[model samples]
Target: MIPLPAGRTAPRTAPVTAPATAPAGRPAPGSVPPQRTASGRPAPGAEPGRDLFVDVLRLLGMALVVLQHWSMPVLSFGDGRIATGNALAAGNMWLVTWVSQVMPLIFFAGGAAGAISFGRAARRGLPAPAWVAARLRRLVLPVVPLAAVWLPLPHLLLAMGLPEQPVLTAARLAGQLLWFLAVYVAVVALTPLLVRLDAAYGLRVPAAMAAGAVVVDLVRFAGGLEAAGYLNIAFVWPAIHQLGLRYATGRPRRPWLIALAGYGAAAALVAAGPYPGSMIGMPGAAVSNMAPPTLALLAVGAGQIGLALALRPCAMAFARLPAVSRVLAWTGPRMMTVYLWHMSALCVVTAMVVVGLGISTPEPGGPAWLAGWPHWLLLLVLALWPLLRAFSRFEMPRPAAPYTGGTVRIAVAAGLAAAGLLLFTAFGFVPGPAPLAGAGLLLSALLLGRTAGPARRNAVPAPGTRR
Candidate 1:
């Protein structure tokens, strides 16, 4: 969700080096002066100043996601292979997913951030296709470094006499995280249209989407057609995304009321309907609120949006503190980097502890686990630090000549990129033609993004290299 500047080559920490406010006559670097409508309110998408609330929410949600992923796994090694279980699968532990499943918040933040970004682009006379292309490039570039390392890793491990199952497990888990990026690409591509829909219909847009989600849930549960549930991917997430669009216009008048209504509906669904209580999928659970995204999850998402809005003042206040601001500045640009590579870091630590040292995870909620949790967390941070340092640069690539192509070609390019991400998510980087094909599609997308207007020097630099 970080809005990386184009062609930025400054040190990674350069983003927040300046004071938040500038002298009387001069605006601070990267600060947008507010543009207001006739009502004396900031214009939609033209709200001046950094959205401290959105930044904090995105960072906190991502951090919690990383912690949850790292802590949930209970690994056991035997017979030259590894088996994995979820610590959260234990009795009554599902309650925690209500708060820990933060994707709704992430999508909300993305919607607000995308509004601001596209607003700025429109004001600068940039077309929608150009803006979409730029965002697509940013999304795809980071994945290149991931693919470069992971595509050949399983083969090397197998050649090194490592067991196939363990190696495949590690590789697949690493790639599975790309599912977010795939869904996000589709959302980004459609934002220009979605924002316009928001302007025209207000809450009705999301209301209609929510109604569609409920009907899809009926088809999924009542008719026993599980495949029908996936249709909510269109209805549910964009509905949440629409709420974010509404937020961009103004803060909710009574967020606590919104929160009460949302959570109340979610609770009703779980208690009286077939929906499961957990927002995330649990091992061995007959119903998962997350994978196919039930109406229960949408209700919880609405509640999360309201809860976050209610806390915005306090969160924004804390985000402005000198210490917190510095952390946000450094971490903001690397949010996507951290999201993409955190699982890889987990893979590394898992290998070292479970496969190498022969240490298996302790029992969930047991005395040993309570005692060892801090040590486990420390190891993960240690493993992730070097990765953050190494791959963070890909977050900003030098600019390509603005994709000067018409909308159709841009759509094609974005489609190819999404397809590539889906390939990685579905087939994984397990040694074979799938990873190679994914890499090719990504490269082809980049190549296709160039314009025929000027002499093309392979417009985009290779993903991880400096020009």
Candidate 2:
């Protein structure tokens, strides 16, 4: 034993450790939260845990999404109504969109997360349906707060004598991002099967999907079947997601080389082919690659996937920094909360600037708006943090453990979530009979009979752990 210093206690002969307990049987697909370790340290050699690279990629995709929404026209008040449109359509910024339009990478990261989650669940004897139910719960829980606020909010605004058009437009923007949520859920539902296909078919699965997308685009353009273009919603993104599936299976053998080639190919197509260079939709553009997800979008998505993989090492290294790691660790679990509330924050800040403060909206393409954007973005971020802290808990609740019946029930939930999100995306959250119906469906899916209130303590998610 070592001698004690002045005013210090002597060390114990042995360091006390947490008593090891036998692993329990697989949870019966309940809505249980994560349990903390008794020793105040994560399990030793926990199975690989979450891949920091994937988390970093998710954060990047989320940041790009935030920036895209932030930069859109806050309030185009000159037309006698509160209107909004993409500000990126202005000036020489078309090239900048090439980098900003990284939505496909979101699905890419999602695919990786899905693959990892499914694999763990399968190992733990968790049934496929329950795993999916849990997965959808994570996605759906965050939307709960947003929907709770917005479902009745539009009606309140209309009753308060707000102008119809401005209210409607704001309603529209509020739910537009739900389109991504709907599509991403579709991709997640397919993950279990996609992983199996990847295991069996190797690279051919992606090749077939890519080829299918191109053929669909041709029919859409040549045969004048604009409806066929919508089919790419199913085709194009899943095709891009396949790239992620391949990556999950240890792919992009030479990520650097692939990134260069893919990017060069996409650029060439946009410059010379039928595709426009802009990755996102733009006003008055005859052929927006994004709207229909043309082959050009796929080309760009391929490039982005390659770029992400190539940068994985760097991103991982940066994420490990002491300060950066602490920030990320704090915010990681609350990411969906930030995303859900940001647009609401934008709406609030926009009104404060335009309506409350009497500052008119700058012209979309003018120099004044451009000069003021950085300042406006800064204000938005500052105003949003408090809202995020207040609302983030809704994203993860301390509800009684949740469980589902069978595959049929899980499928129904997914269908409801997708349909509800689609309605919000296409029609917006207008205070109308039909819109209210959609909101009802959304609420039902989120509630899913969540009888228990959320606990203030955060749920711990560990490696190969179920949340």
Candidate 3:
């Protein structure tokens, strides 16, 4: 979910390995070759060229997430409560998530981008603590505006005599989306260690993680230890992430074979095992493939990665067209804002159409629903545009003075930020102190990331070090 540059195009056959001129003429795992411009010089610092395939995948994954969220949700308001149901819960729609559920791809792309970016910083002598601090700032800052609005808005709405249930619903739903951020925070915080492990062990690291996931699932299912399922979070996401780390340094051989094997494994899991067919959770289902993400989800993720590799040539070609380039460039910078607020946009549209105007949603798969879908999408877009404009400024964090903080301080800052996001994920911004406390933690983390003013000026005297 990390925001990366998206404008520049690279050759469709861009090298995925370190340059041949490097010592030993063999690229080290997790090392990115320096990118060059057409004139054979390094690409500009501010706008270094990006892998077109990764950029395209990131944008497309985000777009699909938004579309799926916007299009689902069957809503109606009555008795001071807004009833909700999933349109995708309707028959046969669950199959679509195989392609549309792109969280794995997002994390994969993030890992790839992190690998390349960290490699470049390492080459330039940037410390690990400083790199992690900068990444925390980018991930946590955009969330400030979101918290500011939500933490107070619920209280204000309740004071105005609005129904408590609906207000609380919106608040919880808003914060629930932060689960991704919380997990990603942990992922990013551990990136330095993970990258090192990847460099040393290569595919063996992910292979080990996958084995752990299989063990967890077996223990979980066999013993009926539902709580034990959460342990897979440690195993599942990082395994997929390691794939991205590998892909950044080199393409896989026979990617289509991977796709075949992955899909076959997933099909077997769903058919012969307890896993559900849907990648995303559905209401009233006996089991959810998503809530604790099963082995099936990981299998499907592998399939998606392999499929993406198989289609890289065409995807990059399509991404290079002038119109597509413009859209990618424009959306890239603002993608974070769009993601954070898209649900809020859904709430606004829901309130206006369902609560204010008393318009109930049509039944899924009905003609009315089919007809109203486009207009519903248009209304959501209308609601979202202003939000995009208002909050996009926070997407690019204000550059902080070079971090003079120690590794412990950087680690603490990251911990505080992750804790805050986790708090929101667990207990949302309802009319309570949790939201305020979460916001305080985030601000504290940001402060810790800053350099000490007087101390830096007077005491920084090391040779070759800047105050």
Tens digit per residue, CA lDDT, model 1, 171-265: 99988878778778888889888878887888899999999999999999999999999999899888987787677666667898888888999
lDDT tens readout by residue for model 2, 19-110: 11224743222111122246754332111233556666777877887888788664645443665566777777778776778777877766
Q: Identify the candidate with maximal TM-score.
A: 3
Among all windows of ten consecutive residues in candidate 3, which has the lowest summed lDDT? Answer: 5-14
Instruction: Give one digit per residue, the lDDT tens place, for model 3 in 5-63.
Output: 22222221222223213356433333323444568764432122456677788888888
List the candidates ranked by lDDT, beginning with the highest: 1, 3, 2
RMSD of each: 7.0, 10.1, 5.1
Best by lDDT: 1
Work out the TM-score per prediction: 0.88, 0.83, 0.89
Better of 1 and 2 by lDDT: 1
Report the Cα lDDT for residue 445, model 2.
Answer: 68
Rank order by TM-score, top first?
Answer: 3, 1, 2
**In every candidate, how many clashes are there?**
0, 4, 0
